[model samples]
Target: MGLGLATGMEFYTFDSVNLVLTDLTGTLGVSADEASWILTVYSCALFLGVPISIWMAGHFGYKRFLLGTVVAFAATSIGCSLAPDLDIMLFWRALQGLAAAGLVMWWRASVYLLMPKPQRSPSLMRISTMLYLSSAAGLLASGYITDHANWRLIFLPNLLYAAGALWLIARHFPNQPKPSAERLVSADWPGIVLLAIALIALQVILNRGEIDDWFGSAHLRILGFVGAGALILFIAWQMSAANRTPLLWLELMRDRNVLSSALLGVLTGMILSGSVFVLPEFLRNVASKTYSATQTGQIMCVYALTAAAIRPLMVGFIARVGQRKAIAFALVMLIMSMLIFNRLLTTGTPGWYFALPLVLYAFCLSPLLPAVGSGTVARIDQNKLLDGVSLYMTFRQFGASLGVALLTILISHRETLHSARLFDHVRHDNDVTRTWLSTVSGTLTTHGGYTPLEAQQASVRMLAEQGAHQAAAYAYADAFAFMAVVGIVALCLLPIVPPTPVQKK
Candidate 1:
């Protein structure tokens, strides 16, 4: 329970600030793009911290490491709340991400390490539910806070979550002996440096790619080569014989189950994170009737709530049908949900119209992570479980970064394409365009108390804005279609995932 709360708090802090970015921008006297660095830095730091935490846990003991991270997380939360400017806030946010990485990774790895094989599934389910609820609540809470109170208040709730998690850990968690100096000296410093360079470069590219015009910009072009080269070198260095102490054990990927699970993690992360990013933007900006942040939060909550509700049934379902078949079924459902979004979503669609598809998406997504995680953990050597878990999570984070970057670019390109095509049809020579403009101009003249010349300019401006909105809607629909295609690719990979071992009752 304590572990779950700590994990929940990490996810909540990560997600809650998303809705409050505008508030941060206004208060900190930064541009919207600058404020986004708050999130970008956190994600990058979290990714970098995952394997390091695994290494530290091995030497320092999981109990002591977890407690330290929990304290740091709480302290950083307070720091974030008290930060007077963007630079200070980002510094604290990065530290918070590092603390979160340790807390989340160790807590999850501990579940597998401590639980009996049969009990692992249920335990993971409970933790995942906490994740779902807390993540959903973050959006809701942040939206409300931004609307009614100070944006800094968003970070304060982590304090209470941290306090509860601290009590639970101190009371119930077991203690371990101190670390050996021999093991401490064997750290893979080279591999760590390479990994950091790769992750930092990749994160910068993903976060700033669109703003920098991608490879069109000389800086991004340089970053692209550096990031790609670093990743290649990092992979080679990890697999080489010269490294005595490897940060990440690449040999784990030799197991078919582990490899498949990692791939599944990537696919799930891509779709899940991509949709989370897209939906709110759709509601607030692209839709005909814009929704407030609170309203958008309410709509998104349906997805998390429905997933949490159905998680128990997933354990039984996976047990009965096995992991491969269960994931295959879920992938099909995921594709279906994406198609539904692609087909039904439009500028004029109502919020209620999304409820069914969101529920369906939740059902499809709930079974995936736990099912794949349990299968991977059960198959790996117990001693290497932490390595496997960290690697899998790192892949998922990479996938999330890729998805957001890809979709951002896709939306921008498609919106431009769609707007151009729309404008092409709005010419004076087009009969339909002329009639519509005349109607709107006449209406504005009569109802808005405008002169003829004023009404003509206003009607043209309204027409251009409407065209922009429709183009955005079309672009979002294309994004969903792309997700559906990604889902199909995931479905194709299900065959490679080994069947879950049948546990004797």
Candidate 2:
């Protein structure tokens, strides 16, 4: 449990600090688009690494693999802190993602392996709570550090957390024998390579598409073709390798409960991770009011606390209502929360305006994950349980990757459209526009200690800035509205998901 908490902290330390991107960009002498690769590469690596790690864990024994990854994560953190260029930082971040790939998987899998069946649910709930709390705390801690210290310093504290995790694992974890040689040699190497190629191409296209002008650029076109082709081939390979050591558990997709859970995991991943990626960026860069990392972290905590507060009720609620209905309730709350977010968006809205919807979102999302996960594998064949868990988690991480890509593209595209529309009315010949400009100039001249020409220039710049800000704010609102619609569509799938008893395990 202690090791799990430390790992969670290590994962989230970059979450909030990434919000203050201007700080990072300025320090690294990179454009904002390039600086974003710091996150993109990590996610890409993580998404591609999960299934590989799962198999590796079985092959090498869980204890050694877990401990080795922890050490790698610690070493990469030091490299990230010391990196002097964008390429170097991205390299280290990708390595960190590979090292951190199966931390959550190991923690969850350990519960089932180490405890009797009756103890697993409560233990999972407790660990889930700790993980969520650590995620929230990470944003807050990063914000505090970014405000008081340099951006490089944000990576420093992970060393301590990593050390603690190492100590716990080394002293307490038990050893297991490695898998047989035949089992190791039968691994699906080609399928793994195809999946990695597909995901890497997709990530690059998503992150670079807008800047490269999407289909207009040959770079994006080739990547799109490669990603599409590789994905199709990967699916074919997985289906053929069912008798071998397949990377994906292709058989599990035939189960209704597992299939539904995987689909919902995609949506949940999109919504939760998308919110984290977009909200802070919007608040700091697009919104009119300036929010420091600390203030943004406080807003995120509302989500974590609200989620934590509702967790104690989840197990009982699912037991009484069934997993399908519980998920239904969660979908409703989640949809309503997104609607509230769309309704409350404004360039200069009060802080509380954002808090209400986030809290509501927390209530629904907190329980939704555990319910879906437990239900997915509850009645599965004992031998296939590991495959089910790995598939469910891999899809969830893939969903997160999609969410970030979608939101990034949507925000950028909408901002351009909104800015163009808003800028159309800013003509000198328009009486209302001229009057506002004159008024602003006069005010600047009188109170800002500026000459007439200087005041006029300042007024023009101010109006342009305001227009850009308002456009960006509208773009964020559009993204939220899209999420609300997605939730509604997900709600429609509820009838297909049969009710499973919560305590069946």
List where candidate 2 sits over 4 angstroms from the true fold.
179-186, 241-243, 502-505
**Candidate 1 wrongly placed segments (more than 4 Å):** 22-38, 82-89, 178-186, 211-213, 503-505
What TM-score does each of the candidates earn? Answer: 0.93, 0.94
Count clashes in each candidate, considering only residues at least 3 apart in sequence or on different chains.
Answer: 0, 0
Please give, for residues 1-505, the per-residue lDDT of candidate 2 as tens digits. 6557556655565564555566778889998667777776876787777888877887768888888888887788889888898889889989988877777567776776677777777887787777667767777887888888876777777777777788888888877666554433356788888999899888888888888888899988998999899999988878884447778877799998788888887887787677667677877776677888888878877887777777777877777788888888888888888888888888888776888888878878777887788877777886577778778878887887788778878887998999999889788998988999999999999999999999999999999998888898999999988888778877888876777754554
Maximum-TM-score candidate: 2
Model 1 agreement with the true structure over 1-505: per-residue lDDT tens digits: 8998888888788667766666677899997556657766776777778878877876767788888898899899999999999999989988988888897677778888788877888888888888888988888897788778887898888888889999999899888554453323367788888888888887778667777887898988898888788889889988988877777778899999889988988888787667777777788667889787788878888888888888888888888878888888887888888899999889999998888878888978887777777667667787677778987887776676567667777888899899999898889899999999999999999999999999999999999999999999999999999999998999888888887764455
Clashes of 2: 0
lDDT value, candidate 2, whole model: 0.79
Give me candidate 1's TM-score against the actual structure: 0.93
Compared with the true structure, model 2 gives a TM-score of 0.94
In order, what lDDT does every prediction score? 0.82, 0.79
